[model samples]
Target: MDDQRRIFLATASRLGALAALTSASATGRAQNRDGGHAYPFSLGVASGSPLPDAVIIWTRILHDPLNAAATPRLAFSVRWEMAEDEQFRRIVAKGAASAAPELAHSVHVDVTGLRPDRWYWYRFMLGDAVSPVGRTRTVPAASGMPKQLKLAVASCQHWEFGTYAAHRHIAAAAPDLVAFLGDYIYEWGPYQLRHPKSAVRASESFTLADYRARYAQYKTDANLQAAHHAAPWIVTWDDHEVANDYGNEQDERLDPRFLQRRAAAYQAFYEHMPLRLTPRDFAHLRIYQRYDWGKLARFHVLDDRQYRADLACPPPGRGGSNSVQPRTCPALTDLGRGMLGREQEQWLAQGLSSSPARWNILAQQTLMAQNSQLPVVKEGDGRFWTDGWDGYPAARRKLMDTLHTSRASNPLVLSGDVHSFFACELARNPSRPASPDNPLLATEFCGTSITSPSRPQTRTEQYVSMNHGIKYGRSDKRGYMLLTITPSDTSAHFLVLDNVHDDASPIARAAAFVVRDGRAGPVRA
Candidate 1:
């Protein structure tokens, strides 16, 4: 066996031994929740960061999810088990992890030494309360190419706007993997204009405690919890997780204490997420990473918000995004200004160049293709939104150049955060038609939000009419994208809900597109 495989097996064996030693004591502690304490698994059980032989299962012990003070300062011993069946008749792996108050009483157990390409059921125990059974699966073996992979892409769920009916449908679909491309929770809440009756939080999240409580409130949704239990997730956050339209360390308000606020937000995100790595400190957390789905696909998950330059030429006093014409905003073409920053851009270049997978998927936030608000009969006439790829045209060109130079196979980008569904073609110059000289580099499908409201559908239609590269656009729907990847082609279905306000809304496919293997653009399927 390889050295890496051997080391993983050895670590798994050591963990197994340790679990055996603590099983009796842990079980005893679990039988009586520290003398009648409230049930701890209120938020839910989740598993993520899946590998061929391992997956990270997570849960936070919270007697009262909204009130952090309700949790004891002492560490709680949480036992977890993984089995091949829902009944857990044949236990495959068992372990115990400490739910420490320092980490918000969260438990993360990296369960390893399992076969690839199959489903496993897992759960956590605290006192006599057992968490909802979660189902997760490992990817295919490194050298193996699976026949297919079904992925559901979703994001931008504003709680008060509507119920999470989209997530309910996603759980019912039971995809192989779920990719959440940012805005897991809106930093602000209780708009009052939306559903004032069902407000989770009355104020915006600005501190660690506030962020934690906000996450707790969102996690209380049964549909969201069901989605977590349905499949393993791969997540990346965007602006709203910290503050809307914030890039790097700067908030839209340009608050002097933005970094401190960012630090708190980052900590709370770590405490709640099913991530593999812990943040080094409150000041910095690296969320950009890659995941391989066997030899079929490689997911280059990005962190565009944390390392990007401030939005170009915000209105004189404002610090957030604004629509502007390129003729008036020369800074829009600054070559030094970057979306992924230098280091991450270099890393992505290397990954795409060396990737052996058949499909290289860029799982990121926002749209990559050019979307001019006005008609672009000529270059300078088009008005662009400064919040997305249009804000950094040179950086977009650099990324397109990398894709062309590296020749990444079947490059497809999955995006969210615009609260709209968009199917577009990526090229060096998206305003122009794709020709031999100006070839397509990748295909993009940007999903609409789970519950968040978007602009009117007429505006989307206008933008689609103006932008030649955008094959489809729809802002009226609220839902997720279902992608089916095979050796031959990748089919994407834009699934939408009949009513976001209804908890039991019916879901239907709004559109469908397909990108053939080795092709770089999507077509109506």
Candidate 2:
């Protein structure tokens, strides 16, 4: 095997042993596509970005490359079926697609003509062998407004983090949709010890192959695939997908000479994920888009790193992963400042105004809160604005104002990154003195990292006490947040995972929060 492929496989095998020690995600069965085991399912089929009649189904043809070194690109004629019953005796849609070697033998068949807002089960068959069964569904078609919407917003699932305990818990709950806000993969040194993989992928992935190989390793995780198999996902990236704290058109780890890695990462991101392939390639990368869930929600997904200014503090630094909570100050106003550039902002503003969706959801990867430590602590208290909206105060204010002026029926911001859980009320005019009338224009729920370590709760509580604007905070848990929305009310199900490495983890509680329509703020339940 080539060095790259060997590393990827060896890493999975090595970590597989340790990963079993703590992860509930690995509990399904000793079935992997590696061929040494029964290899029960082909990473189970998944569908995402649902439309009235179409949902994209994805699966990879896994073969024993070790037995046939030349067959790294596994190929097979695969058949998929979506049915109203567990048995295909009552099939709704069926089709044939070839998982060709050029695409790493992965299949992305966009299936159309299915009922909307209804349940369906699906699976893939390769020859006489069938894959694991998974369930997925579409949203209400346009003009239809259903009552409740359940979405699970998650991010930062590092591979070695004890078996995707968070993913298993999410699957058990069976949310309607999963919004993966970012940090889907960490592309750096010092990967968490919890990662089951033996050694990490290249620390600086700058080529299409590097990115693809990285994703292949991540997708091999049973817990991750289960989450995908269980429900369609709404994914948006925050650093780590490409590189840490990366801003638009910049490199976090690459030297000036190796910037071409960006194209590599972008293209690989496309090939591995369930995302569709297009003939067009912007320097060999594909990302950035939005999705709407009927009138109940209109999700405006943003790529924070695609177009951002580098972090300002500790000068001459690339923004990513540096000081997950960076330094703050004058650098916050650099003219190059921007979280979401002009075009994106305008598009979002336009979408917010034109769309009739009752809820305007900005699904992003950073904190929108303007927090500056009072009686300022050390040089970098992780408050530096360069890494997030704080880096561009003017731009953040504009976005906040647009939501305020548009009077979006209910504006809610869901984000990942910052590695903790935060619930806050956004003030269009935070500058205004605290008053009942200084109405909060929007609500923000920052989900904790899916598996990333949060700063200890003790320190976080101390910081929260000092920073009043931060309504609540918790930094020492490896879990995700669940969001339940209704036309008249939106509540967050802050689902907590007991142990990331445990074989049978339990979800602690569904900490609830409610936002009354038009009131524009979340109240603790």
Candidate 3:
């Protein structure tokens, strides 16, 4: 059946749509009864660097990958084994856990007391058969620095856009951690696909089940799974995970209440992610968190939604995305007009001011530098852009000022979103600089999207030209970025995928940037 037809049928019967998720076939049980095989393992194991020492290991138990009659609801004791050597000659940590079908049989065990600044291999076991062996590592103790650190970032991966060829490239780089900047899944319409048959979106995800199904589908992709199995991943969410342009308390569309949708999104995000759940009573918050990667760098991963005020628009739109009377929005400078609520801001500020790490990296989303407003659009964009930090001038300024005054060493802002890629020297005022020596305290590198379609150089040139702050830009490609930080200089290379249209495609280097130590900005080389 076609994608649109699938949607028409699924929406026609909501309960039937759900029943299919739990459907089982008879061929599955017969093989299981007679085959006398070991347990089945499908979802491979993964780890996250939400903290040092502690690593979250995850797996999903399955009855069988080939059997249709096998139920996905089987509860099983998922066992984990971590070894020091790739040969498994020396085992370090061993643990056991259980996941019932009610929870999708997914398990996450936070393993502690492992060696830091070290590489480890792990596998999930059921009975006789074992899962695909995955590799993971822990951040060294604070004040400990690796001679080098390799990390990759990416966002906006719509299955319909193309294959995860970028993921294949990331796996080859052999990064210590994959810092996923969000939009791991796109809630796109099925009609958006040019290769319609490959990607089929039958339902709009709103409830927890829908969200989980979305994650499960993405998890099934070979490239995405390969990357996850290749290294521990650090993840955060962006608007598309819920709805596009849905920021703070505002929803651009009139379809769903922001908070209700947020709760569902968060629950599903945590369940599929390698995140250690922080059990809360009734209140829900997933906006802010920090990670210390040894003493080399401290990552302050933040949420710019939940607490943001309404948007600033000269004219209003259909929903709340970016509309005027956004004055209908509260005062953005209202101290309460927080993108990061007071509590999160305070936490971030304290972390920045007191961080002893050599590099304090702000691993967040959105373009931090100043973006052009008008005539520039006519020149290059062919359309005006006001979706991200550009829409919230006040919030952007506050964060910039905080960075300018802080003493953190080599403070660099790593961001995504804008679909397009932007590398800029973030100044107190990009249109004009106040001081040369203190050209402004930091640098901002905005990576491009995973599979989201972006404008070409023809469309982005004029915008970059008009916007004095932007040093470089490209919206034509879908790929990820490899940020290599060393004691001498922090270098970032945009790892562009040769093509995502083909499944077997390989990636190649597109560009590179080196922000030397003591240098306040990034210079393309």
Candidate 4:
């Protein structure tokens, strides 16, 4: 036997009687008659970070997902296989990874040496238990130009509010990639508030175990799992992943122990994701990165939560977001304040300046276009929401300047977390309508949350009317955005669920917009 296979066998032998009880059929599906242990792959399998010749496939060996203490302390050998076909007959790559209890027994296998721009099926095995098979594909080679790209963008799934019917539909669409723009799991839960009989946790997650259990509970949802299994995902976090409206090291409550809580949450996030980088000290995780879809598109996925300044002019003793009149709040105009921090801002500028792709996609959390609560007919009439881009006007202006000066080709910003679908023309000053002097610089399609509730539709209408650049806004529905990108143009479809309370709810296109090549704004399609 080869050294790798021999080593894998030696490690598998450590499972002792359990490994001996393992058996498989012709398709490599584990058939374990062993009744001594609970199933290990209850959380399902996923793949992400698709490079030209590599993708990260992940799974966690959880006997009792709700309780991290149930996992044994010993290291376990996990076997993974990738094939060109659903059946294992054409296995292209196979490897073994060690799932230690330190990372909650999670396995992240960065499989490489595969052909680019091709679909593959992968699964994980831990002794007698086998994970669900997942479908993934690598991006086209860096220099190669592809004709089209289909992408599904989604975010803000609060487990208690509604069902993940949107994710179910996303899986059905089978987009080339899934970009999760954050709030994968809310930091707190009152299970009885919405779904009275639900078994999810009823408190906030503050420790490592709590965070892990929360993630486990969310993963139990089959629709979300199906979405993960359908395509390679690119993910970034928003506030809810740690605490609602949290910025930098401060939570809404301004607890002195907030950083410790954040560390636990960050570690849990890393453990559950199929990411390329590992967290440093469980406190800092550099999630902002770039991905190229051949020469067709360049995705600049960003992290806006970790390094942002705290919400300007928060209520006394509170550190989270609030609504404030920019004219009255002097701190709102701080030129030094930034939403993406200094380093990330520079990196983004550099990327935008150097990218040669036909489309430049800024996949981020929350809306980028300015949305004032009141009409901006005069200087002091506008009321801005402190949680989004309006909170950092200087930074937003800087980003818009970069897009303009860099002359980034067909710049498109995809955002979420507001729980509303918004189509807007990004301009130097979004308060006023686009014109010859202050022209549109890019297009933005901010999708609604998967299940999170939104403000009333009437209020959304008012905001749309007040924000001249916003071509469309809808807060009544909950869903995701589907993007079809080509050399000539990019189309966005706002797909909404009829009933988020029902897991099998039907979905429909609520709106559609198209941005043609070399154009700066989206027009109704």
**Model 1 ranges off by over 4 Å:** 1-35, 190-202
Worst 10 residues of 3 by lDDT: 18-27
Model 3, span 312-399: residue lDDT tens: 4524444444422223334422443446667777788899988877788888878887666433322123122345665565667677
Superposition-based RMSD of candidate 4 using all C-alpha atoms, in angstroms? 7.1
Which runs in model 2 stand beyond 4 Å of their true positions?
Answer: 1-42, 64-75, 188-206, 276-279, 282-286, 317-329, 374-385, 429-438
Q: Candidates' lDDT values, in order?
A: 0.85, 0.67, 0.68, 0.86
- The better-scoring model by TM-score among 2 and 4 is 4
In candidate 3, clashing pairs total 6
- Candidate 1 residue pairs that clash: 30-127
- Candidate 1 vs candidate 3: the TM-score winner is 1
Error of 1 at 6 (Å): 34
Per-residue error at 121 for model 3, in Å?
0.9
Model 3 misplaced regions, further than 4 Å: 1-40, 62-74, 189-202, 279-283, 314-317, 323-336, 373-384
Among these predicted structures, which one has the highest lDDT? 4
Tens digits of per-residue lDDT for model 2, 1-525: 763254334333433443352132223333434434433233445677776667777776654211223234556788988897666689999989887766667778787888888767788877555666666787788888878887888988766555577876666556788888888877753322235534455455555655655665566565676677667887777777777666666655535743566666665555556664473564534355667788888888877677666555534444343322433355555556676766777788888888788888999988887555342344444453357666666677778789977767788999788878888778754434336776677889988877777667887777666553467777777788888888888988777777776746787864678888877767888
lDDT at residue 511 of model 2 (Cα atoms): 65
| lDDT of candidate 4 over 70-177, digit per residue (tens) | 668889999999998777789999999999888989999999999999989999987776777788899999999898999999999988888888887887776889
Cα error, candidate 1, residue 103 (Å): 1.2
Model 1 over residues 390-463: C-alpha lDDT tens digits?
Answer: 89889899999999999889899999989999999988888789999898889999999998888999999999
- When 1 and 3 are scored with lDDT, the better candidate is 1
